[model samples]
Target chain A: MTVTKGDVERLIDASIGAAPAPTMDQVKEFVTKTLDYNFAMTLTEPFYIKPNAEILHAAGKKLCTVISYPLGSYTHEAKLAQLKQALADGADECDIAMDVSAFKSGQYDKVKEDLKPCVELMGDKVCKLLYFASLLTEDEQKRAIEMAIDLGFPMLKTNPGFGFSTTVDQVKLAHDFAGDKIGIMVSGGVRTKDDAIAFVEAGVSRIATSAAFQIMADFDK
Target chain B: MNKKELAKYIDQTDLTPGEPYDKITEFCKDAAENGFASVCILPTLVKTAAAALKGTDTKVCTVVSFPLGMDYPEIKEIETKEAIENGAEEIDMVMNVGALKGGDYDIVNDELARVSKACHDKGVLLKLIIETTLLTDEQIVKACELAEANGVDIVKTSTGFKKMLPRSTSVEDVQLIRAHIKPETGLKAAGGIRTTEDALKMIEAGATRIGASSGKDIVDGLAE
Candidate 1:
């Protein structure tokens, strides 16, 4: 079981989000670093989409922007507007945040309604439906996966990482439920190469992390 | 300041992610009864807070683009309009921090102008959150200038989201922005303001409003 740098890079979704805001230089440096690693994609906010689009495309790497972000409290209309604009801003993928409160409150209809238009707008693009899996019940996780599959989202991202920890078991659960019908992206808390390897072995289709460089640096050691 | 007077300067907040509606309604009821300035909440709960605080003096303040503030100006404007329609009296819209930090003042100005117009069109007060913890002193002053130029009614400090770097609002942040803006423009100090003393320091530094989750405790501390 030898893990190489390419193994890590092939499955890694390198991400760099500054605490409050990122300067153009910081964004540029990070994009360059991620591209140097030749990771699968770069997860960024909508603000960086247009500025980083050309470089990301030239490298044949995807640019994913999260709408509604770590907290999915925005209304359906707000989510739709952000999704439309992010795509217009040249994002290759839009990871739509789930309305966790509505889903947690048993307002399944409201959650579905909130995501329907976003999924429709994303159409054939890589739309990853993100859920704060660390906070949900098993039934809730299942429902989220099923809904994403039904809504035609190609990927399911577990958690948005701003303190939310995505367990290997959660990735396995999503993999078991979706099979090959939906790709599973494990986000948040995968800070080490070993953590990434465990998730990849657990059937995770991709890994999104702010610690991509650290994980790659630790690959041999 | 006494409890009653201090209460008028506080925006009782509960932006905890995934908080239930019932809890928000209860929190709003409590804040309204306590006579806090407003109850800052997520956009989804603005309607609930509005209903709970109806017939009370406390206004409903909701966030747009929230902690990140990186959304396009158009989306921020849409969020402002929707929150206002849902009964938000005051909007704490996150300024496009990335634009401001990237030296893209045009993008920052466009966002401020758009959200300001949306909020002002509905006669809703707009507080532009600069996330002071992330900026340099110079950037903070520039942010105040851009916020004022766009007709922002208030300049807020942070989203209090507990970021990777883990910074908080300081009295100097409030004072710096206060000194830069016109006297008529309001200043709000949020993020890590938990104690009565913390609230007073912000007010002393020229903060006209305080956004805190511990509004009740601060007010009660003054009461006792």
Candidate 2:
């Protein structure tokens, strides 16, 4: 069965990371072209910092910025500053990476503290915490998901597209842990429409990918 | 150079994506033990590295706008400030390659100046990664000129994420950058200096700093 346009749009977080920095024109092209198919534009901090958030918002696009990006190891203060700047730049959503190192070191308090400020600052805007699921053990992952739930985060993302590909098992783990309270976003290696469908079938609420355009095109076929 | 001497020029790096805290801790430990100049990591790890290397001479260095330096000037400046506040002693930022290549020197110069000032205000050194692998020799020279003119502390060669170009750091590129930069300004060779011999050749070609993930191995090779 072919995926509906609404289904593609609802489940896709169009990303522009891993590639070289795109020019303003390129970002415009991306924003304009994917306006119909993408749920939001997940841009790297720099690209998000460019003065296009207003335009994207005008075009009815949700501007999402990655905080501390692929490595969620920033000090609380640094991440706070980044969140504030992105918000000031008109970002409607914040996809932050949890401090993976702190989490791994069993410094859950530090990790919680690191994420707290962004959630507080984001206020009503969408705030999705990236857990980098492959880096964490089952218990750690569960604890992280529980913390995110406690923190009132509406979404929990897996992988930052840097480490291991976001597997269905990991998505299922998040799904099993979160159930319906937290929306799951699976990123990293969901490059094709089939991958996106597999993830959606596995119970992921969203798919973060740099190849959203290609995936949507493939779905049309 | 001997192992001890070579250590002074190394900025032990682990900018690997998704690097864990334990690994960063280990990298900092190795850097301090090896007498390396600094431990270069993603900006997120600056505080951890600073804490790990406290009381040591090794500095805490973090990347700004990172492997791809296309962020707005305001963002880079903010990132530099945040890094310094988090205990980063040095900032290695990528120049806007598209702007530089497009001959938008004004945009490039302006961004560098803003970030350079942020680093200088904190007494933190700033390195501009030109990503030599992606540029023409002429573009490289222009970039070096802009970097030196803007008072960047060092001009770095690559971010080690060779996407569209070869990732190697050539001695000739170092010489070319060294040729354009002032004597006081340093040159850092990164991206592909994987061996002791490669590091030495870069140093011989006038690189004052070496950014490498293979710091331990390179230092180990120096012993033999």
Candidate 3:
């Protein structure tokens, strides 16, 4: 049987939980190693952000990065600016932060406006949106999904690792609500393959776990 | 003019927090000189950009609730009014990710329609921010359906930090949206597009609009 990268990605996410990203040097080493792990690195700037091209060629891995970073608090212009920078930094995939505060503060119009520049920046590139707690209410959560659906983003991310991690309920909601539109991804608290599978069964196509490396290395026989 | 030849398709965004008014002025001037599609600024800076781009085709764009997509309908409407009064020609708003997860499609649809109406009342074009990474494929399709049903002009992805979904855009996903969306409807891809090749890939994938901080690079790449 051939081991596909997608299988490995699911396995690793299921096995590992969300932890802080590795240091740049460590990432370089990890990238050099041949593995089935998908790496997404969030950076504050372009400095020290390595592990692309050569690593993908050497190790056969994909790298994920973030634009604007950590918070969806910037204006459309600034968010767009960051999107361009993140792509230029050589990220294969990008996980963008949703404007949680804007949704929470009852600025509905502003919420839609926040994504314009980023949309313009990516222009059909792969991108993930970390909803975080913007959907404090059931209504908000549904609206958030619709937002993702309309934008054509493939993955529905649960957390930004800022507060709560991906929960069973959250994954289920994503799958149950929009299973046909996109893939569901569980991040934050998932630390085991079983945990990742639970999300997978819930219709999650991916899992974001920082412990992916160890999980893949220690897969049970 | 062809969309490619026209600078109106390129916009200069200035949503950086703690940015000085003078910097906004500079951005507006730069956008005008570069023949950008528009100048995206904060609601507060809309007037600054608008005044700077006055008499030029470079319109002013502003956002509401910013990077977040959770807000009451009324709040969004009010914010839309505020942005327009400040001279923003286009409006980009976030959608409530929470509500969609909760299966609250009605609220999502109603809220988006309301915001669209508010923007249309003032003749300003409205683009919805789906925050794509935060959603599922089914949800992504549904959101596109809703946007098309409403009068919303564009469907965009991502807010920079957290994603609507955990992963990034896939070629399959773009094609799926393209297959379904109406011809007049526009698709924007944001988040991790850096090089001209990346932009070209997205364009081939059916996205017409791109959001990025590296506008100059892409434009330069286009020139090259």
By TM-score, who's the top model here? Answer: 1
TM-score order of candidates, best first?
A: 1, 2, 3
DockQ-wise, the better of 1 and 3 is 1
How many clashes (backbone atoms < 3 Å, residues ≥3 apart in a chain or on different chains) does model 1 have?
0
**C-alpha RMSD of each candidate structure in angstroms:** 1.7, 2.8, 18.5
TM-score per candidate, chains pooled: 0.95, 0.89, 0.51
From the highest DockQ down, the ranking of the candidates is 1, 2, 3
Estimate, for each residue in A1-221, the C-alpha lDDT of model 2 and write its tens digit: 65565686677878764445455666666666666654756454544344567666677767777887656655565567667777877888889888787677788897788788779898988889898888888988899999999887999988877535888999999898779999998888988888988888898888888888788778678
lDDT tens readout by residue for model 3, B12-131: 565554344566788888877777777776665676678888988777887775655544455566667767877888888876665565577776787788889888888888888776
Worst 10 residues of 2 chain B by lDDT: B160-169
**Native-to-model Cα distance after best TM-score fit, residue B212 in candidate 2, in Å:** 1.2
Where is model 3 chain A poorest over a 10-residue stretch in terms of lDDT? Answer: A13-22
User: Residue B50 lDDT in model 2?
Assistant: 88
Supply fnat for every model shown.
Answer: 0.58, 0.34, 0.00
How far residue B97's Cα lies from its native spot in candidate 3, in Å, is: 1.5
Instruction: Report lDDT per candidate.
Output: 0.86, 0.81, 0.63
Q: What local lDDT score does residue B58 receive in model 3, on the 0 to 100 scale?
A: 74
Q: Scoring each candidate complex against the real one, what DockQ results?
A: 0.64, 0.33, 0.02
